[model samples]
Target chain A: MAKMTLDQLRKLREEKKGDMVRREVEGKEIQIIVGMGTCGIAAGAKEAFDAIVQTVDENGIASSVVIRQTGCMGLCHVEPTVEVVMPGMPATIYGRVDAEVARQIVRRHVVEKNLVENHIYDRPAVDIVKK
Target chain B: MHFSVSDFLLDLVQNSIEAGARTVTVRVVEDRGLIEASVGDDGKGMDEAVKAKAMDPFWTDGEKHARRRVGLGIPFLVHALRQAGGDWELESAPGSGTLWRFSFPADGVDTPPLGDMAGLALSAMAFDGDYELVMERRAPARGTEWTVRRSELRDAVGELTDAGSLTLARAFLESQEEPLDGIE
Candidate 1:
């Protein structure tokens, strides 16, 4: 459990910095944001979030996929919601997501570019405010 | 209610941050079939009455968030640890800091898995605020003890939540985990 040497840490930092630069230049970055507010945590969003991260890592897609944790999205009923944003694509919000669904999202929605129809929760916006 | 050890830890760390802690320290140690964890924070500590209520799943201070009616973080951890033949204690005094210490049988059949600590550490950094987080992992069997500080990480990179910084932090945190053979 001894800490890594300063040289090792420096090298790792440099590697990560290089990776970030490479990903940015590729312009194919995907961001996966997981709601982790109190409601989300009570509903087990942590597991789903971790599952997605592990899936992305296991598939060696870390260079292209970025996972982030965020506060509530005002959808308490859909506690463990995950929002995915891909380059040149509309952001997709998935509801009632579990660990298994998280994996599916990465595989189908992210990799294959096919939205998982059943999990999509966002609806078309309506103009309700008076002009 | 359902969470891995890492999840539990992240929740607890968030709790400390919400308590207005300027500094938080988390330590996990495995020794002789026992796994011990402690989180200490220099936050707005609780008195006896508040401490008692904090242990109740149905009780919440109502100051943090108005929408939520219950605080299950402490209670849930207590439940899991006790179910696994472990015990926990909390020490706090108003105007002082708080410390939570818990231990469980490492090999217990009901003990939850350690899960992903790297993710936990990264998430802790995502928390809103400028508080410091110190994490240490010790495995006597392997004669290894690794320690890290949030400030040091920030100094190394720019921000922990940045993509590149997060990647580096995750790698560093994961590297501290004890080998499978060292857990027992």
Candidate 2:
């Protein structure tokens, strides 16, 4: 019933190789992490996650940014959280990120090089785990 | 509590990921009136005693979340299934893996509507790790079925985290699921 099949995917792959100039995800500059744990999903992280993806895709910055889904960040009170790590910019964690907030996050914090200060939940140490 | 079955699937699959599963399989069979779903993972599983303990609402071992003080996933799942006139099956053991199966009346008063399948697939694929997810959906009444394999997707699209690929992936999943699913 679907239009995009295995063949379509392969075709897209080939076409993308020719047309799309994508950067390697391994050493990306910006990394966006969305909490996908039970609590987060219950609070509608699924929609937020999709919205972030859609926004980033629309903005055409899929090359430099890598979107990731993480389990939990220990912020149960504010489920559906989004953490942005731009490597050089100060990392930020926004709480209660709905679809709209998720889009704003990608547009403001990630694309425009600013932070969503009001919704800031917590700023992690960037390295909670010892290397 | 999980508002929709999609969230339930995500929660349990995340459990599998946390348990160290290298491969995970998810199946959903939906007819006009019934919805049956299952998720099996090759992750470290719980024994009989541990499984029983995990079902307790007051139990907390940081198994699912570091800040999750109470056991809400399984307990609420059982509670929701019962309220929806559904039953469940779970198979697991120490050193083995875990499999969860359940079905509910789609028209039940307590049943939640389907969530966005495209989002579910994209979210699962977005996890940062080396794991494979095989998602299968079937609608016998409509005689339609579709399956997405992680390895195949990876081969087609280098990394799912890329926004361009994710967009394409979401479009593909939505197209496949549009005819088979209900309200989100």
Candidate 3:
């Protein structure tokens, strides 16, 4: 297929920029990252990723949430891991996440601010040093 | 070792982008008892020596990631395709580009499902870079064919990165692949 002209591309980019800005200004503040490394993919991270995206979109919360994919987090055993980072909160990592678990993570942890106990995998442990 | 063909394709596209490709095209054609998938990229193509070594699972450029010591994308594909009685080819020149094509028996038990084509394509577009992606699928068994271009999509939906635009792109790609879902 022939490529689109530069003018056309620029026009589209401009038109979309306005929409993006408006959405960003109104949306909530949350970021969700899904592990999509080879191990993660083999363990069904793709489905979890899609499920999270679909749930967010269907709930009309796309503006508030930013979803992304990342390489392995050196936790191959816990394949299909998802990390959720919210404002003023420590990053939470959930492993062995499937489609259903992903939806719950979005609805509960992301929306309701309640960590789903069963699915929570990792929380940074504070270290104290006394001299 | 990907679970689905879409995942595999996504990996291939990632490889292309990592190779500095500005334009990537993927074509999947299912016909005559075979499924053929081809990915072409206008990237910094490898020389003959590198091309020959690309299939080695232990070989890598060792420059992209400081900790990464191996490249398994092409090697994995080669193993999977070979195990399923399939074949693959790679053509590249130092300054030109690269084209990698592989085909396997459509009815082979080891052949993976195509997975979510739309999701894969859209995800590729979501990469943080200035590039264009085109995906085409021709399923003779289902007597259907369709093509999606990122440039055209940008024209239709303003920007692909926008949430609304992404939703539209996903829906459009899904619609195109819906009819062919049951064929295989």
Candidate 4:
């Protein structure tokens, strides 16, 4: 197989622009870091990742959520560790994540603008969603 | 905090798990500034089509609507290696297994630095008692290598902690510090 270059991938993505959904970043920009490490993938981070991306697009919540994949966070035990970062707010790392929890993250943190206590990993949490 | 060699290994292991192979072997061999790492699993291997797209960032096989197929882990590492003047390869057979190789300039910033390897080893425990991870490291004249089998840890702990499950969360992290090598 021909190895893919970043430029080639970027071009392919552009050609399929219709299929590409722009995550709403209109509101307060929030960063959702999905641990896509091997362990996280095996544990089903893909499903959870899809749920989060779809929710952000379907809701048209601009400036609402920005998702990206990161390397291992040393919490391999969590398999799927999600770090939610909001401006002026202390980032929270949640473990044992899945699609259901991802929805909760969107509804509660992105919509209702509240933290899902159980999923919040950063202790002594601060207002991570501050504008 | 986001990416590392250990994390890369974990993603390859996912492919192994999907293959239905209960036993997965991971080896990390390093010499001088060169690193050769491979992850192999007895799981169902991918067909030509799947294998072709596996490395495409816009063709994610595991997600419903992933932006690309080249999973972030592979692409990210590829980008990292390229920037560091390194290389990587993916090889697998439908029924045989998958073997991924990543060679990096050990000192390059692009080649992801190794993260808590011990922590990664412990995560293997989470697999169904049948799963296993074999890791090896060689630094030039320093032929000191290491391999950890979930089966062995299960025996040592006297119980399979479902190492990946949330239940063994703390234990999983702690196990990284278990006496595995001369590294205190």
The alpha-carbon deviation from the true structure for residue B33 of candidate 3, after best TM-score superposition, in angstroms, is: 1.6
- On lDDT, the candidate that comes out on top is 2
Query: How does chain B score by TM in each prediction?
Result: 0.91, 0.89, 0.91, 0.75
Instruction: Write one digit per residue (lDDT tens) for candidate 1, span B21-80.
Output: 999998888898888888899999999999899889888886644444566778888889
Tens-digit lDDT track of model 3 for B31-126: 988888999999999998999888897777755444445567777888888788888889999778899998889899988776777788777666
Q: Write the per-residue lDDT of candidate 2 for residues A1-131, one digit (tens) a residue.
A: 44478778778867765555663333557889988876788788888888998898777678778888887776767888999998657888899899999999999888787887678887332322223
Query: What's the TM-score of every candidate structure?
Result: 0.75, 0.89, 0.79, 0.52
Q: What is the C-alpha RMSD of each candidate to the true structure, in Å?
A: 5.2, 3.9, 6.1, 17.8
Instruction: Provide per-model DockQ scores.
Output: 0.22, 0.48, 0.16, 0.04
Where in model 2 is the C-alpha error above 4 Å? A17-19, A22-28, A123-131, B63-68, B180-184
Q: Per-residue alpha-carbon lDDT of model 2 for B40-101, expressed as tens digits? A: 99899898988998889877666444444466678888888988889799999978899999
Q: Best to worst by lDDT, what's the order?
A: 2, 1, 3, 4
Q: What RMSD does model 4 have?
A: 17.8
TM-score of 3: 0.79
Candidate 4 lDDT tens digits, B38-125: 7777777777888777656655663422322235555655666677798777777788877778777777766777655555554444
Each candidate's clash count: 1, 0, 0, 34
TM-score of chain B alone in model 3 = 0.91
The digit string of per-residue lDDT tens for model 3 on A1-131 reads: 22334355456556655665664534557888887756677788878877887777666666667777766555556778899998756689998899999999988887778887766676321221112
DockQ of 1: 0.22
